[model samples]
Target: MKRPYKKTDLPVWQVRKFLEPGPIVLVSSHWQGKNNIMAMGWHTVLEFSPSLLGCMITSANHSFDMVRKSGECVINIPTADMIDTIIAIGNSHGPRVNKFTRFGLTPEPAATVKAPLIRECYANIECRLADRRLVDKYNFFIFEVLKAQAATYPAYPKTVHYRGEGVFMVSGKNIAMPEKFRKGNL
Candidate 1:
């Protein structure tokens, strides 16, 4: 009785917009002893064992080139207070402007990767490039999380999610369904 699903052609921009908000990741990469940070909204956990994560960086971004050359990156998860800084970094080009200096963000040496970590962020993950072919065709990069740590946070701290363009939303309230409606309701 269910309607048959149909595939429809859509532009990449449209497809990107249709997807829900994703976690904001501050990706740091180093090359030639110079470091750079880029605000990325497209990232996700790919595996548990060995802690794998996937991220997408536009081919045109300066950070992409650094990652390609260094084969390492740090994924920093910032709290709500960092929304402004994140937006500023995302809106500007790293080659033209040093985001760390412009935003007054500290660049601390990562324990496992050549890239640095955002000191202001609540959490950070040091990763090495596990796969690069994904970037060749889709501008996506896969990383194997080598180490991770967290700063002090409340039981529930507000996190920012990028909605697109210059828009962002904070982590909202939580909801729990009744046991009957949770699973196997039918």
Candidate 2:
């Protein structure tokens, strides 16, 4: 079979466009005496059995310095209803803006880390830095999940995913697949 479209030059900046269709999450961290939060989209799973995750925080972000210093953070996943709030959080500077108070966000103490868990989120995953070897070169950090929390009702809440260039997509419809699998997969 032959491919339909001819190959074209791909720009360096658009490299992440294909990989950018991921749920937006808010990363909260604490360092010194401050609690900071940042909206993140560049994260992926490293493992599922033990639940390891990898994230990239640019050097310019305010949460980068705090997460680097404290070595701990909370990944808070919000529903599609909070898309506007997420954009506001991402646009504002964390150092000058008190997101929690300004956005009317409720902060709850995390079980395993100093970072606060956002009560409004659908899920919150507490994490600790697992490796920092690539942070200097790539601004990437490997995190090990310490604890996790999720809401019970509305099991499949709509989640918003970023598609780059001020655009987003929302999760729709839930489907179940019956297939062979391990008994204790969960």
Candidate 3:
């Protein structure tokens, strides 16, 4: 058994550094002949069946209004190698900049949404707004994944996850123990 380590009080706002879930995905939105990409880390998988994903997009973000009005967006998972691109996109403004052109990212037409997929990313999930109940209160958007695609070369791409305050961690290794789980759990 391992020994318990000493603990220290953490600020409530800084708790995200330890509680941040999932990878930093690039959300693509298109509305009124414009397309934009923004990096998002505040998202979670709500359900497995029908593929529900909940993302918190601050109202101040340019993609928020575009996604709200268009009712659709594409969530693209980028590999760890594209960390620089992700940071650039997150730091830049949307309306004044064309991310696809500025970042030299190829935009491919999505099958179920107007938003284009980033060809360089490992996977792209097309989503449609399913619920807006929390949008006004928390700027949260529940989306039902309509279509998903991924690269077959790497079983799982090395994804980058935020740790707050300009720090990031890259996904490493996979430990599969499906047999240890109860029948349908895996």
Query: For this target, which candidate reaches the highest lDDT against the unseen true structure?
Result: 3
Residue runs of model 3 more than 4 Å from their true location after superposition:
none
User: Ten residues in a row with the worst lDDT in model 1?
Assistant: 177-186
Off by over 4 Å in 1: 1-12, 176-186
The TM-score leader among the candidates is 3
Superior by lDDT: candidate 1 or candidate 2: 2
Looking at model 2, residue 138 earns an lDDT score of 96
Q: Write the per-residue lDDT of candidate 2 for residues 1-186, one digit (tens) a residue.
A: 977987789887876767785789999888887888889999999998678999999999989899988999999999999998999999988889889988889989999999999999999999999999988899999999999989997888789888788988898987675455566653
Give the Å error, residue 65, model 1.
0.4
TM-score of candidate 1 against the unseen true structure: 0.83
Model 3, 79-128: lDDT tens digits are: 89999999999999898999999999999999999999999999999999
* Model 1 per-residue lDDT at 47: 82
Query: What pairs collide in candidate 3?
Result: none
TM-score for each model? 0.83, 0.90, 0.98
lDDT of 1 by residue, 84-164 (tens): 888888888878887888999999998998899989888888999998888899989899999999866565667888766
The candidates, ranked best first by TM-score, are: 3, 2, 1
